[model samples]
Target: MDHGSSHDDEVLGKAFDLRLMRRLVRFLVPYRGLFSVCVLLILVLTGIQSGLPYISKIAIDRFLTLPWAIVTVESAPGSGAPIPLGDDRYLVEISSLSPELRKEWEISGVLSPTRYLFVEEDSDKEGIALEHPDLFAPIAGGYIASESALRSLSPSETLSLRSGAIAGLIRLSILFAIALIVRFVFGVSQVYLLQLTGQKVMYDMRREIFGHVLRLPLSYFDRAPVGRLVTRVTNDVAAINEMFTSMLVNLFRDAFLIFAVMGIMFHLEWRVALVILALFPLIVIAAFEFRRRARAAYREVRRQIARLNAYLQESISGMRIVQLFVQEVKANERFAKINIDKYKASMRQLLTFAVFRPLMSFLSSFAVAIVIWYGGLNVLRGSLSLGALTAFIQYVRMLFEPILELSQGYNILQGAMAAAERIFILLDEPEEDRGGGEAIEEVEGRIEFRNVWFAYNDEEWILKDVSFTVEPGERVAIVGPTGSGKTTIIRLLLRMYPLQKGEILLDGVPIERLDLGFLRSRMAVVLQDVFLFSGDIMDNIRLRAEIPEEEAIEAARFANADFVEDLPDGYRTEVKERGVTLSVGERQLLSFARAVAFKPEILVLDEATASIDSQTESLIQRSLTKIMEDRTSIVIAHRLSTIREADKIIVLHKGKVVEEGTHTELLARGGLYAALHRLQFAELGGGTDPAPPSPSFSEG
Candidate 1:
C-alpha cells in the first residue's frame, strides 16, 4: 500500500451545503450560554480594536504639536509668570520682559524653590532688598517701577487653549493603550477556553459515534464502507476544529469591526464615508461568491479522501488474498485510479482558494484606492485636513479587513458542515434488536425456529419457512451447503439482523422479547474468521472483565492453547495488529479461549474447526466434550468427524431440512445425510466404522 495515495487522491467539490451547516449548529445548542459570553467578549474586543488606529491619528494631530499655552504674571518685577511646562521641564518668568533675559529671571525662581540660598545677603528672613538697582525692579504700585512687556498675554492665552486640547489627546492615547492590553489578555483567554471546550465536545462526540456504530444492526455495515466511517470519527471531526474555534469567535469580531469602523467614518465626514459605502456592496458580493465555490471544493476534497481511505483499508485487510492470487499489479492499478481522482480533487480545491483569496485582496485594495483618490482631493481643497484624510483612508482599509476574515471563516464553516452530515448519518442509522422486554439471567437453550422466512433483499427469499428445534443442553449440529442459510440462522439467533417472518424462542420465551445486551453476554460465539485486538493474550481472552492472571491461564489451558506459554513472554506476549504474530491455528485457539472465559450459557461454534490442522482439530475435539458438558451448544459444521457424536444432527439443503436424527440413524436412512457421510468417508479413505445404527430410530 502506498501511503502517498492518501494525499494524492482526495476529492474536491461542493458536496456539503447549507443544510449540513444547520444540522451542525444544533450541537452548540447546549453551549449557547457560553457561546453568548464569548460573542459578547468578541464584540467588546472588536470595538476596542477598531478605534486603535483612529486614536493613533488623534494623538499624532494634537499632542504631537508644540505647546500652545503660556501663563503670564505681571508682578511688578517680583511676582513670577508660569509658562506651561516645556515638554517635561518647568519655566518661570520673574517679570514681564524681553525673551532674551527670561531664562536668567526663571533661574532665580528655580533656586528660590530649592533652598532660598544666600537669603539675599541681608541675614533677615522677613525681606531682602537688592544692593544693585540694575538687577531688581520695583513694581509701579511700589516705588518708581516702570514695566514694559514683549509678547503679551494674548499669545499666552492661545497657547493655553492648545495645551488643553493636547492634554485631552494624550489622555485618549493612554486609554487606547489600556484597551489594547485588555484585548490581548482577553483574546488569549478566550482562545484557550474555546479550545478546551471544543476538544471536550470532540471527545464526547467520538465516543457517542463509536457507541452508536456498534449498536447499529450488522446489516448496516454491509452497505457502509468501514474506512469512510472511521474517517467520519477521525479526520472529518478534526477538520471542524477550526470552525469550533475561530468561526465561533470571529462571527462577532468581524461583524463588530466592520460596523464600528463604518459608523465612525460616517460621523467623521459623510461625503468621504459614502465612498466606502459604495464599495461595501462589491466586497460583500465577492465574499459570498467566493464562499460558495470554496465550500463546494472543500466538500469534494473530503469525499475523495474518504473514498481513497476506504480503498486502502480494504486492500490492506485483504493483502494475503491479493498475494496468493498474484493480482498485485491489478490492485495497484485500481488504487492508482482512486489516487489520481483524489489528486485532481485536491488541486481543484487549492485552485478555488487561490482565486477566492486574491479576489478578496483585490476588493480591499480597490476600497483603499477610492479613499486615497477622493480624500486626497478633499485635503487639497481645504475641505479636510491632511491628518483627517490619512485617518479616513485607514478606515477604508479597516472595512475590507473583515471581508478577508469572513472568507476564511467560510472555509471553516464548510468543513464543519461536511463532518456534521456524516455524524448525523451515523446517528440516524437503525439500532439492533434490543428486545421489547427484560432478559432472563438463566436461559434454557431449547431454541425453536417456527416458519422463519427472510431475505436480505426483497427480490428473493434466502430462508424459506425454516423450522427446527434443539433440546436444552443438546449438542446439535446444523449441517448444510454454502448459501444454505446456515450462517443466516446464526445471525438471526444473535439478533444481529431481524428475521423477516419468524419467532425464535429460548425456553418458551420469544428471542425478540429478551434484552439484547444480556442475551449477547450469555451467548458466546467463535467464528472461522476471528478478529483479535492489538494487546496481550490475556487481554484478548478477558476482553470485558479484568480476570486474574491465573484464571486467564486456566482458560487458555482448557481451550488447549497452552502453546501461548511457549511464546517469548507467555501470556503477556504482545499481539501485533490483527494478531499477525500468531498463526491462524493459534489465533483460533485464542478465540476459543475467549469464548470459554465468558462462561456463556449457550456457545455457538460456526466453522470453528475449519482453519485448524488435524492435530489441532483433535486437540479441540478433546476439549469440546468437557466444555459442552453442561452448556447447550449450537455447532454449525461441515466436517463429518466433528459432528459424528452430536446428540442430534440436522441436514439442510437449500434452506430446507432434508433429514434429522442421531448420526448412526441418519447413516442408516441413506438420504441426504448418508450421502454427505459417504462423501466425507471416501475423501478421508476411512473404509468403515463399527458404530451401529439403533434398531428402532425415528427420523423426520
Candidate 2:
C-alpha cells in the first residue's frame, strides 16, 4: 500500500451549516442540564445588563433635578384669613381681607407682589392690570402666584424638600449599586458554567474521535499523516471548544442584549428607534462581507498549518537520511517554504479581523452620533426629556456592541464549522471489518493456504496463486529473495489484510469464517523490526496482558534473554522512546520474550534474527527449538543457515512458489535454494562443502 498523500485538506463549508449544527448538538445531549443552566445565566445576565442604563436615566431625571409644585387655596365663612404660599407669602383676595389682616400681610416676606384682574368686574371693560406681571399670571379669575419667583419657603418646608430630594438620590444610588453587583455575580457565574460545559463537551468529542481513529484499518494510516490526525484530535477539537465556550453562549447574550436595547429605545421614543433601525442594513451587509472573507482566510490557515506540520514531522523522522545524504539545505528550503505559506495564510486571517474590527467600531460610533444629533433636537423642543435622550444614546451604543461582537463571533463560528467538518469526516471513516463468523476458544494449529492471490493495489499481485499447508505441530520455513512475497504470506496468515482471491484455513475451517480477534489471538508473530514502547522492560514483555510476573520471567529465561536480569532494575528497566537506549539485538531479544509470554499455539517469525550478534544468535537458536517444541511454526528466513533443519522448506520467486522440500533435498535438486545456499557459502569464504550443524545457525 502506498503510504503517502492524504486527501483531507478540503475547503470549509458555510459559517452556519445546519447539518453540521445538528450533528454537533448531539454531543451536548448528555450534558443538557449544564447547558441549560448556562443558557439561563446568559438570559439573566442580559436582563441585568439592559436594566443598568434605564436605572441611570431614572436617577438623572428624577432625583438630580427639582420639580415644580402647585398649591390651591379656598376661603371659609367667618374665617377671612390669608393662605400662606411660601416664606410667609399670603394669597388674600382684595374683598376678603380686613384692614388689620392686610397690615399683617404687608409685614410678611412678600416684598412686591404681582396682582392681576381677579375676574373682569365689568363685562365690556378691562380692570386694572397687575404691576408684577412677570411674577404672576392670571389663570381663571383669582390671581395665581409663583412662590419660586415671588417668595421664599418657610424653614420647615425648605428642610422637608431638601430631605425628600436627598432620600430620592440615595434610593436611586442604592438601586444602581445593586444592579451592578448582581450583574457582576451573574456574569461570573455564566462564564464559569459556559467554560465548564465547553470543556466537558470537548472531552467527549476528543475521546470519541481518538477512539475512532484507533479502530480504523491500517490501510487508512498508510495515507493519513500522524500530524494531521494529531491536529484533528487536538487543534481541531480546541476550535470547537472555543465555539462552545465563547461563541455559543455569547451568541444568545448578544442577541438578547440587542433585543432588550431595541425594546427600551422604542418604548422611550419610537422615532429615535426608527433612526437606529435604518443603520441595521449597513451593519448586516458589513457582517456578511466579513463572514465570507474570514471563512476563506481561516480555512486556508487550517490547511496551511496542516501542511506545515506534516512536513515538519516527515523531516524530523527522516533527519537521519537527510543528514546522511548531506541534504540539510534542501530540507530546510522545503520547510521554509511551508512555514512561509502558513505565515501568509495566518496574516490573511489577521488582516481580515483587523479590518472588520475597526470598521465595526467606526460604524458603532456613527450610530451613536446619529442618536445624539436627532435625540438632542427633540430634547431642545421639550418633546423628549433630557434624561430619556441620554438613555437612548446609551442604548444605541449597547446595540452596536452586540453587533460588533456578533461579527467577531461569526469568525469563530466559521473556524468551528471548519474544524467540525474535518472531525466528522474522520469519525465517518469505516472501521476495520469485524467479520460475522463463529468464534473459537482454541485452534489445533493446522494451517493451509489455497489458491491465494493478493495485491496491495489493482491486480499487480504480490502473492500469485500460492498454495501451501503445514500439519499440526509442524515447522515450515519459507525462503525467497526480496519482493518474492515471503513476508506477505506471514501477513496473510495473521489476517492483517483481507484475501483478495483465496481461502486460508486453520484446522480445516476457513480463516475468513473465523472470528477476527479469536483467530489472531491463537498466533504470535515476531517481526524483524522490533518496536518498543516507552515503558519498563517488564511491561514491554507482557504488554499489559495480565501475565503473572513468574510466567514473564520464565518466558524471558526460555527466550535466553538473561541480559535483562543483569540490568540495574532487571525487568523493571525503563525503555526510552522506541527503545533507543537498547541495542537492536537487545530489542529483538525482548520481542522474542514477548512472543513467548503470549504462549500462542502457532509461532510466525519473519526475519527475526537478522540483526543479532553471533553470541546472541547462539542463545536465540537454542531458544527457537524450545519455542517450537510442540507448536506449528512458520519461519521466513533470509540466512540459509537459519532454516537448514526445517521439516519443510518452500522456495518462492517472483510471487510464485518454485520448490518445496527439506534443505538437503532442495540442495541436491540444485534449484533456487541450492543457488542461494552456494552464494552464502561463497560469501563466508567456504567452498561448496556443507558446514557442520550448529545451534547458532538454527532457525531464528
Candidate 3:
C-alpha cells in the first residue's frame, strides 16, 4: 500500500522514537526477568512455528514417495557414485545425492525422474512383492517397482505392501500432534506472562500519576480541564499498555519468526531462498511508507478520542445546567460533532490497514509464485526435493505474515508514544510546595492578615492592601457587597493562593511556615454551597478522620441536624452523588456537622445560612450561638440582620474596610454600613431604621 495518501503523513522518523522509548523502558526494570522469559519464549515459538512445514516435507519425501532413482550413467558421466545395474542402468539413492551434483546429472541426461521402491529380500513385505511379480523387477539382493506399477495391485495387497510406510506416517502424525500441543501450552503461558507484565507496568504508572496529581497545586487544576486529566489517568495509560502487550511482544516474536523462517528456508534450498529474498527491498519500502501513514492516522485517532471523552465528561457533568438553560440540543450537536470526528479518525486508521493488508498479501503471493516457478523446475530435474519446495511455499507465507502484524505494531508504537509524551508532561510538573516548615501540634486561634494584596490575574487586585485581625475566642462578622473580595480573603487565609504583597500569620507565626496539613487541620470552613461525596450521612460527617461514631452523632446534634433520626435509614442513608437526594438545608446541616466534627480551633462560615429557609436558618443561628461560645469564628454574610449581635462587625466596600465596630456602633456612625442596612431595611418592609437614615447606594 502507498502510505503517502494522508496529508498529515509527516516523516518516517516519527514512526519510531528512541528518547520516548528509553524513558518508557524504566517501567520494565522490575519485570525484566519476566520480559526475558517472554523473549526466550519467542525464540522457542518461532523455532516450533518454522518446523511445522519441514514435518510435512519429511512425510512427503520419506514415506509417500519412492526413494530410488534410475541413472543412465552408461552414456553420460554423473558426479555421484552410483551402483552399476545390468543392461546399462545404475541404481541411485536420490536422497543421498547433493543438490548440485544431482541437478548436474539430471541435466546431463544421466538421472531418471522415475522413482522406484525396493523391497528387501526375506522381509515380511517380500511375500506381497513376490505375488505381484509382474509389477516387481529383480535387483541386487532386493525386488524393485515403480509406484505406478504398485497401483495395479488389489487394495488389501497394497495396504499390506505399504504397511511400513503407514506405521512411519502414524509416528510422524504423533510427532506433529505433540508439537502442536507444546506450542499451545507455551503460547498460552507466554500470553499470560506478557499481559501480566503489561498490567503491572500500567498499575505502577497510574498510581504514580495519581499520586503526583494529588500533590500538585490547586492553581494547576484551576485552569486544567477535569476531563482531560481523567484521560491522562485512563485512556492515555491504556494506550501505553497496548504498546507493551501487543506491539512490544509482537515485535520480539515477529523478528524472531522472520529470521527463523529465513534461516530454515536457506537451509532447505539456498537457490529458492535467494529468489524469495529478492523481493525483500520491496517489503522494506512498503513497510516504511505504511509506518509514516499509520503514525499520522493513529495520532489523529487518539486526538479525536481525547476530544470525544472530554466533551462527553463535561456534558454529562453539566447536564443539569444544560437542561436548566434549555441547551440540550446544542449539547447534543456538539457531542455529535466530536463523535463524528472520532469516527472519521477511526475510518482513516482502518483504511490504512485495509490497504496495507492486501498489499502484504500480494507480496506474499508474489514471493510464493517465484518460489514455485523456480523450485518446481529444480524438483523435476532432481536437484530440489518436492518436499523442500512445498516447505519453501509455507515459509514464504510465514515470512510475510509478520509484516502484516508489523503494520499494526507501527500504529501501536505511535499511539503509545503520543500517550507517553502527554503522561510525561504531567509527571514533569513540580509538586506543590509543602511548606517546608514546622509541624505544630497545636496553636491558639489568633488570625492576622497584614497589608495583603492579591489577584488571580496579573495585578488586577482582588484584595488591595487589606489588613484585619481576629483575636483568640472572638466572633468577627465581615459584611460586604457581592464583589467585595470576601471569598478571596478566605482563600488567602487558607493559603490556597500565595500573597502578592504582605503576609498572613496564624498564632504569631507566618502561615507559610506552618506545615500545610497542620495548618488546614486546625481550621474548618463551612460555605453556602455544600459538597458531599457518595456515602452514608455518618461517613460524610466523619470523613477519613478517626472521629468516633458517637462524636459524629454529637456533632450532628450540635449542628441541629437531628432531622436524620426521623428518616427511615437515619444516619446510614445512602448519599447519592453530591448528596443530591437531600434538600439544600439538609446538605448545609451535613456540612455544618462535618465542620463541627473536626473540632477545629477556628471556624469560618461564608454566607452559610444565606441559602437556607427561615426555619433552617433559625436552627443554624441557635446552633451557631452555642458552637461559637468559646471558638474563634469569622463569618462573611450579606444579610446585615444576621450580624447585629456580633462581637465585632467589619464593613468592607470594594476591598477596603470602611467601618470597624459592633453592628450597633456602625449603624450609629451612619457610614457604608448604615447605608447598606437602610437599603435592606426598605426592601424587607421593616418597621423603622434603628439609627437616622443614611443615603442608599445609588443616592450616596
Among these predictions, the greatest lDDT belongs to 3
For each candidate in the order shown, give its overall lDDT on alpha carbons: 0.69, 0.76, 0.81
Q: Is candidate 1 or candidate 3 better by TM-score?
A: 3
Between candidates 1 and 2, the TM-score winner: 2
Candidate 2 to truth, TM: 0.83
lDDT tens digits, residues 330-448, model 2? 98998888889889999999999999988988998898898889988765544455677888878888888888788778877877898899999899999977665676666779999
In model 3, the Cα lDDT at residue 284 comes to 85
List the candidates ranked by TM-score, beginning with the highest. 3, 2, 1
Clashing pairs in 2: none
TM-score of each: 0.79, 0.83, 0.89
RMSD of each: 11.1, 10.0, 5.2
Across 1-700, the per-residue lDDT of candidate 3 in tens digits comes to: 1112221222223535788889899999999999999888878887899899999998998788887888775553354545567778887777787777676776686778788887889998888888888999877777889989988989998788778778989999999999999999999999999999999999999999999999998778886666557778887799899999999888888988888889988887778888888899899889888877877787788667656655766677778999999998888887788789889999998998889888988998998998899999888766677888898899899999887888768777776887787788789998877785676556789999899889999989888888889999999998877778888888888888888899899988888888888888888999888988887889999996599999999999998888988879999998887788788889988888899999999999888767666557667777777778789989886544457767898777788877899977988899888888777676656523222222322111
- Report the number of clashing residue pairs per model: 16, 0, 0
Candidate 1 TM-score versus the reference: 0.79
Clashes of 2: 0
lDDT winner between candidates 1 and 3? 3
For model 2 the local lDDT of residue 475 reads 91
